[model samples]
Target chain A: MHPQLQLLVALQDMTGMIKEVEEKGSELEGMGFKTAGLDDLKRAREELEGQIEPQLMGAFQRLTAKFGRAVVPVVGNHCTGCFAQIPSSFVSKTNAGKLQRCESCGRILYWP
Target chain B: MDIAEVLKNTSPELFLPDLKATDKESALSELVAGLTAGMDIKNPDTILQMLQSRESLGSTAVGPGIAFPHGRTLAVQRLTILMARSTAGVDFDSEDGEPTHLFFVLIAPPQDLGHQYIKSLATLIDTVQEASLREKLMAADDYEAFCAALRGE
Candidate 1:
């Protein structure tokens, strides 16, 4: 994976964690797990986002707002985000292929 | 898509009754090492990194002695749950300030953002809250007993 894409993946994971905790706080509390430091998690997401370039991060943010996952894996030449077929040209062994967006969902695509 | 699916995917190898790790990193390493085969991507390191990044945000330790260390990543093809009992206990920096005896690592593909992923976690959390379940798990000498205990039998 490209280092930038890798960083984006990390940021998305962080964002997902925070969102789940917020969305599931009551259920988590029912099981006795403390849902604290969510703000700290947001801070961590910001810190991670700072590492990515503005242009890429802007696209990421826009796509994530439209669709829950900004970055998605390409499985069997199909975008897992929207299940659209990714063209063969974009699917390559090179790291740059992972940094491209799915023409269908516009979600960033990467090979798992 | 359901707990049965999660159960269907698991075997005795994924359940450890005697984990040797004394810290979170080693415990995760041990669990990830045991679960590498489940990752379709064949990248256990990426799975481990995903787990660690989630932990870095906050300890997933919920109750007295159980921790639900979970995350989503491209490494896994489905909702993967690998559980272990740290006989010596591991410090996961729990909010309760107690040693975690039960460790349940939940990792899945990013596409399972809703429904199946969250439901699986909820089911696991509900199952572990039973005191009888914990007692039986601690006494389980093998996978069958551990599973039975998990089922509240």
Candidate 2:
């Protein structure tokens, strides 16, 4: 993974957890989610955001807002984000450590 | 997702009828090991780190001796829900302050096209919350009987 892609993937994971907690905070309360830790989650998100570049961070926010997720993995010559067949050459580009995105969903792609 | 289908496609190794971890983090480590042993997940250390981070926010152990520790990561290709029962019970910091007996660990790749991750999570939450099902789950002796019990057989 490209260094930036690594950070982006981690940030994406953090963002997903933060969003889920924010969206389902109430439903998760007695279900054993410490709703009190919502602030802690937000703080953790901010911490992750701090380590990422502003441009990439902006792109992540915009993309996740447009789609459900900001980053996805490439699974078997296909972009799992949009289920689109990725050209074989594109896989090489990603493997060469170039930043890549799914042409269909416009979501960032990482070779996980 | 059909539990039976997932189990069949994956392996019965994912089902741990008797868990050996006694604490929250250890139980999660056991589940993560089972996940890797049973499926084609890569980067389990990262998976364990993410799961621990989720637990730091809140204990998933709640409602009638059940714990649902779940996370989304780049490590997996699809949604996976694995079950493990600790006969002696693991202390998962349950909300009701009871020892957690049943564990449902949900792992998903970030690209959940059909939202199966959340939907399956909701279903598991609803299913295990029922006292009747929890009892059946605990009583199941092996993976096959466990699947049957889950399917209400």
Candidate 3:
């Protein structure tokens, strides 16, 4: 269960890293002089993009392992995952894919 | 308009519409119109102008078939949200290279509540990106269907 939650956080950090590498690489390229550092940066960017897919898969796998599904859209006063009362309105709008915040904990709910 | 109020007002009736635009301008226009309509707010052009202003600064397309176009105005009392679905999708010069079909056009009354609006928007996106939700919206037939989709029934 912990792994499931942590996987999401990990995926977020990975995305952040990928973005930072990309921005840095672009900055280096904008300067437009081939250098060893730039080459390393390019390599890093390639590596990060490559990691994205595997990380995404890993995150999903972990979530499914914990919840028996990827993510559950809350249905009417219940956490689809935990079966608890989220606010009535929260349940109402989220099911419709409108404004969704977990009334109980404020996690954005998504329909599976 | 403050960006914060828009996110606060986001609800099912205001959330589900297929964007399916062929390009950015049409997509934004459709999105603004949809959000304004859902919230029952007056003057769609005012909100459209707000979105255009934001676009002038930079494209709101955040890539991966998503665009978060937003603006603020003093004439509004509350935030308004519009959702659009474009099965055909549109080009917003996104880095993700996936034609954008989902847009979260946010219009708000100017206020110090900007940060909360942004935070709520971020939260909304986190929810929207859930596995099949975007696809479900794309599959919807019309505005009514879109509303049903948002209501998650």
Best by TM-score: 1
> Which scores higher on DockQ, 2 or 3?
2
Worst 10 residues of 2 chain A by lDDT: A27-36
| Model 3 lDDT tens row, A1-112 | 2233333322332333334335443532332211233344345435544554565556555654655444344444566556667765643544443534345544434421
Best by DockQ: 2
Model 2 per-residue lDDT tens digits across residues B1-153: 654444443347778889899898799989999998888775676678678778878788756798888878887777777788999999999878889999888888765656676666666676666688778888887888888887778
Winner on DockQ (1 vs 2): 2
State which candidate, 2 or 3, has the greater TM-score. Answer: 2
C-alpha DockQ of every model: 0.41, 0.44, 0.02
Interface Cα root-mean-square deviation for all models: 2.4, 2.0, 16.5
Q: Which residue pairs show backbone clashes in model 1? A: none
Which ranges in model 2 have alpha carbons more than 4 Å from their true place? A1-4, A30-32, A53-68, A80-107, B1-11, B111-114, B129-135
CAPRI rating of model 2? acceptable
> Predictions ranked by DockQ, top down?
2, 1, 3
Name the lDDT of candidate 1.
0.76
How accurately is candidate 1 docked according to DockQ? 0.41
| Alpha carbon RMSD to native, model 3 | 18.0
